[model samples]
Target chain A: MAVAHAANDYRLGAQAVADGVYVFSGRNEHFTRDNGGNIVNTGFIVGTDAVIVIDTGPSLQYGEQQRKAIAAITRVPVRQVYVTHQHPDHYLGDAAYADASIAALPATISAIQTQGNALADNLYRLVGGWMAGTQSQSPTSTATPGVVEIGGRKLRLIGTAGHTAGDLMVYDEASRTLFAGDLVFHDRAPTTPNADLLQWLNALDQIRQIDFKVLVPGHGAVVRDASAIEQTRDYLQWLSTSLHTAAEQGRDMVEVMNQPLPERFQKLAVHDEEYRRSVSHLYPAIELTTLPRR
Target chain B: MSRARAALLVCALWCAGSLPAHAATAVDTPVDPLNSPSWQYMRQRFLGKDPMVFDARVQVQMPSAAEDQMQVPVHVSAPGLTDVVDVLVFADLNPLPKILRYQPTSAAPDIGFRFKVEQSTPVRAAMRTRDGVWHVGGAWLRASGGGCTAPSVGTGQGFWQDRLGEISARLWPQQPGLERLRLRMIHPMDTGLAAGIPVFHIDRIDMRASDGRLLASLQTYEPVSENPVISVDLQHSGPVRIDAHDIQGNRFAATVTP
Candidate 1:
């Protein structure tokens, strides 16, 4: 199906969550040709001399469109782009940020180098023509954890794992805005194709201690408080516990996929699809652990 | 059998018998039944010239939509057929279409396992009865495709290497005379379709009782999911031993007690 040129454009708009901190909140849905694979939240922080992009969008067109949107707000050229993790949606747009220094955690960089192409291929199949010009782009540099000052603005990068092998959360010291990356998804069900639920819960605990006024999740609308983190943690905990219980009871994958979700998660976007995907991603290992050895 | 049921059976047998002679090419003919586009070719390849019918007695269960294309769960059972000699399972549109050949020598004909679907296709399970007739059954599965070519998540990180050949199994008591054996093996059933990765997958699994009587055997293919998990119900069980091997010549053995 051919998308109209008008609909092809992401039409990304920057919503200011805090002073000089703008978030391009994405649709709370899975990747599709209609959405142009723009099912991720990417943001930029405008500093006096330069701008720091939190994460890139899904494709080259998205990244270019995002760059134009950022320019509409500030002429400060993007000095650095921080990829939150190795997931395709977050990094496939790195090609458009060729002028800026793209950085990620070491593990995430390695993952991108190895599995990025495969992940990109999967997305191309899922999102169809929207992923036409998209390709996997490796990070240009390693993002070391800790505070770094650029253009008179200080940002703290917290290196953690759980969502994937490496998740980088950027904290804007000036605006007290924490770009929680995929570590904290608000109103959107978390994707666990490469997740360690226990580690993800620990990462959430780490995020809980961060002193930030505004939290910019990797997806969904920007939030102000710890509710988003709590939501992610609660959902992950319930998912882990339910999978383990299912394994202990000798339930098959199909049965586990069909398990009823808690009422609280009924409102979460893509809950059914994400839950089934998570079961396929994690049930085998859980089953291995729960099965008896005689 | 009832008069009408026996007559319908005879008609089905006659139709199946006349398929090869007639060389039927129709998509929905009784001989070339099932909604799959590749049923005719698959029937000829797997069942050869044997008489076959789309029998409701052979039940094949698969999700209508494959949430994870790389690991779609499937279950097949022919409880109504008593003298089933062999069961063949396959996907019609997969690049690697043949999935497995299961022989329920001493175990029940029911089995549950996982496999990969490259795209939206019909997955079929055909059971051979004592009369050499193939009872076919299947369901159409919708998927985004690319399951076989994509490298497994565990393989890139070397996660499966350390736990390779490790088998975890359990025997659960069911009803009075039956027992369910659920087992999982740690191996990335790589299809060799991905770049830089060779095809390495478990190809054979034999289940035996403690007394050395062979219960069931399954010959699998690369389309089987990584770290395959299978459940089989046994007619008689105390302790069941599982002997398996992959394409790389690695052998794994495990035993579970009831």
Candidate 2:
């Protein structure tokens, strides 16, 4: 069990899920520097020969401190750093791990290169000095999706699209641990800024079939069963239905935004706020698809 | 660090060094250094050292966050400006943020319209209320970011292509002798915020009679939104026409007849 960290602690306590498998669990909360920008859960697999780090956090400070956390565990050289998605919190710290060969999808790489600086600038404004010395860094390698053998562990690469244009989930055959990047937000509200809800629903189905003992989500606590993925799907479906119905009814954005949050999402941190922001980001695309040309 | 990162770091340092120099000068100066050069040139061309007062009486009502950065609703009104002579609107972050140079014909002129807000920026409205005192009111609208630089998300490719210089206008008599003229021109209004997206926006517009009697000639900057919408209340209604052109030398003209 991971020790409950007080707010403002940058030091991470890696919780052991199984033999040689550990996760640096982030606070199931919003992105704040006091929490060390630990708004996303990242994983590392220590093998006999090497270590593979998953999803570096938001900034240079985070990457540097996370490196220290890794040092406390095993000194196995980090073979590759997989940036699971395009969001600033996931890939902006690739610069901090400049030594490691950063790997991401070719599309995600392009996105990070094109929109990365703007994302960094936005994060700088959002988190202030937490982004200091951290500039945008695109991935170093666009490795093809396949089974990546790190030391002796077999990581079956699963490519899923929905939460973003490219979402990567690695399932370790040996450990039965699934590293589900922003695809599953566990208990917290999943972000849908660039989501295709239909595809997101489909992606959840793919995640469900994977027989994994431990499921590490991008933003929340480790999932023990399929309930977390189902919760995410339910939220996405509700959001999609709400947006589609509002568009069909010719309801304006203000009216759609004021719609009360469903009882299911009430338990998530920042659920009300994320729902409001999601409505702003995703509603227009939904409206565009449904509305006839003027 | 690579050579590129090192050079970037040097440039970052130089920018940081110059920021404090500009920071002290910008206390209530209503200026963003990144967009200062164009602002200075525009200031020299438009109003030079005019006495400007920061006033709260003049209400500049605008959204806190623009759902669509391309079309931000802005309403500027001075309730008791019976002798209003001039009004100006501008944004600090736009390439040529100076949106309007208005000479209101009505003694009590109120503007309620929508325009582009490129980034999270202050939309300033300056009014000259006959006394020659320029009362400036401003409201900061949090943008989705990159209005001027982003292509129209509502339209597909070739959406603005061949559609440039296209003018749509409606001139109708509303109140006996008064006429309401609303003009919309199709343009991307790119603010140069998006990568590889250059600044392309309608630079100027003139609403006039067919005989060349100018009703209003608005000198605009880059943050004028895509498909710029302008409405003017005219004291007289007759054969009216509008001549508009972007910075790219695309010309459009539309005439509304009785």
Candidate 3:
């Protein structure tokens, strides 16, 4: 799960994710795991008519790389760049694809406006020199999704928060490929701050309801079946359940982590160090005895 | 006699001119090493020197207030004192007090890295010599805080059972015998970021030569990014064997011949 290596490898390769959908994975070599998603920015070339770019990537340099990837396919005027979320990695590079109406959920736009500057500053410091071509400012003040389109080409934009307050999953009907933005993890666990464990399970259920042939994770390799999604869902559910049980029992956080989790989960990318924190966040939410009833 | 008296007068005059208006007389204060705040655990746990005298001039670069403490970038530099052998970073407030320890083969005194800061607390970087004389510096950083309990960065659980072995050393020899060894592993490095998951941490990584001699050994923590990329200076004089083990002794070993 060396995300840094992934970012540096796929700068401008027009690798196909689905039939028409092409993912332009950005350079992977970086200090930290630039959690924008392994796929630098995703998009598709629709015949000779127009090309719709999915996400713009983290910075201006990333945008340039995504553009070059698009150029390899078709010179068609880039009509629209659909941003999956408000996270800077998905939307900050919007300026690079100028003239294309930057599209996103209204909620994402608001989240960007609210925390863009602060997020940029925080990320810039963490990334150091890797943020060379990124937007100088977070664009928090000015970033408003110019053309907010909901569903496109049978690909539904599902509001899946918890990972972040404003996360959306793009479901392509034709390809049955769900571009899960930090929602699914094939190799590692998803980082969740605004994590509503229950809401996340519900969201996973929604994702499951859809019949998808392939699941394109926000990071890692593409998942080809529902089983992958199930693994992720089960992991979150188990964590919630375990944390809930601990909180219900009035157990000490440290003591709970010291106790081994389910053997099924030991191999799952859960960090031992983070056990206490996970318990703290989920303990309150899981304290509700009516989870099973819900 | 006369010459010594003249020198003393000249020194006194120079001090008077250089002194600030509110300068207080320099007092010979008792040095109580117990009062100084350094990670005693790191000193006792790791094989390092003790009674380290901390210097105040060397300050670390960190935000006054960070919005996100998940991956806070920190830079520590020792401008002078080339004789120092290594500088180790330790945080008093973090769950893992020892953040990173750099044993530099080169002459570079400055080392910068991106790591997760748990909370608003003082971070100390102690530099020690071959003779075990430790010189220390520290700084207070106000991070957004949430490392001890932050969620895992991965999507699901752990590394794929298939990919677990892939976590090994990938060595590319720039020239003959001298190789640039990039050893990567699939580790979650769960810095107590999230809730529910149990404690699973890789405590020590011993990188040794084939002849049973040690090249470099790291006492790691959850703060190190997942699948920590450790680049070691390998001379390729002998075959290499790197054995990395978690706190639970789940050993992942790799071998390479540069």
Candidate 4:
């Protein structure tokens, strides 16, 4: 069993999930809205000699901080840093961990490079000093898959498209730890702006087949039960099916969002406040239900 | 010159005088930006949820067309002084109705500013006088879509902080006594629409005066630009400080010398 500590601070923590697998928490702090709050990037540090980082945080400064934390655990040189997907927070920090061979799916690399800088410029202007000068620095490795490694070992990148194009999750067989990136959310509702419901549900099915005991999601706390994955999958299944029906019934996006989640999965944690954004993004993807655009 | 030639020359002058300005020779119909539901709600409310302020007499000036919807610059100003109490600009059918709202607290009645236009939509600006009345003016702007869907620019991660200048107070006057000045800063009034690596949006922004007094507060949407720059006329001279805080507790402050 992984030891639980309140530590007061949300950013700092470490727990051994299995014999050789250790999970470290990240800074989950972010902006609050009229509805709820946003989940910032918090990744896991895996392995000893040949360490693999799950997801890089938001900026170069944050990336450096993540590296500093990983170094404290083990002095092993990081062999590879695998980004969960190509969002600014998860991948932009690639610069700080520049020495490590950065690896992610080709699509993720494209999303980061093509729209990365422009997005960063817009955010920097809005947040101002909160940007920490990360705005001015150019994105280090955009759309370039430096070290491409496909499915292997205790960890394998499973394709999940409901969240974003080229969204992938790392499955750890030894520890049964699925670093489900943004694929699974513990408490907060998942953002599906770039998602496809049908493909997302199928990805969930694929994730279910993995023999894992604990699931550490892209957002929220570490979920130690395999059922949590099933629950999230089921939620997506219900949402996708119901939303499709609703769309067919000529229901608007807001009505679809207002529609409550399945009572059975209500106990399963999801960020309900983020539903509007999810509906806005997923509706388009679901409405276009054909083949995966990517 | 002969009498016939003189008569012909007079006719030519009359024709020239009767014609409009070279640029005004052609007037193209404006496009509407609020085609989507999200944007439609925004434009309707901006004009005044009630009695709908419409700028009927004022002339609306915009480039007959625009290429970039993301950074399409919009300027709204009236040439003559009339019975104008307040001026509210609307990007008709934009997600937000009141794109720009101005009430003249100064001697000058003319007002001007810029905003991020969401789509190829009609942009309207209205002016209301001190007598509790409202007037409006409008133009069409051609903008691209997916600005709200577009990811936020810059580091959309971590707890970053900085200061921003205020439009109402952070103005440097060449002379003293309530200078009508314009100040702008970059910002993304994320409408909680765009999805980041971690799915979320920047929701709230709070602005305050140098002494930490309230100046202006606004709730933004994805319809606003990735980086939103707001311009406002101010009545102050000297070193003024402005602080802006986002919903994430990210704070920015700045000081300007007039």
Predicted structure with the largest TM-score when compared to the true one: 1
lDDT tens digits, residue span B53-119, model 3: 4444344654444434654545566676665567677777777777777665432344443456677
- Per residue, candidate 1 scores C-alpha lDDT tens digits across A105-186 of 9999999999999889888877887776888988999999999998888999999999998999999998899999999999
Interface RMSD of each: 2.1, 7.9, 18.4, 20.3
- Scored by CA lDDT, what does every candidate get? 0.86, 0.71, 0.58, 0.51
What local lDDT score does residue B214 receive in model 1, on the 0 to 100 scale? 91
Q: Residue B44 in candidate 1 has what lDDT?
A: 70
Q: Comparing candidate 2 with candidate 3, which one achieves the higher lDDT?
A: 2
Better of 1 and 3 by lDDT: 1
Pairwise lDDT winner, candidates 1 and 4? 1
Worst 10-residue lDDT window, candidate 4 chain B: B25-34
Q: Which candidate wins on DockQ?
A: 1
lDDT string, candidate 1, B1-258, tens digits? 243245447547666657666535323335334457777788778877666777767777766788778889988887667889899999999999999999988778878899888999888888988776677777778997689999988898899889898888888877776788898888989999999999889999999988889999999899998888898888875889899998878999988887
DockQ of 3: 0.02
Single out the weakest 10-residue window by summed lDDT for candidate 1 chain B. Answer: B25-34
Off by over 4 Å in 3: A1-10, A25-47, A136-154, A252-294, B1-258
Report the error of model 2 at residue A189, Å: 2.4
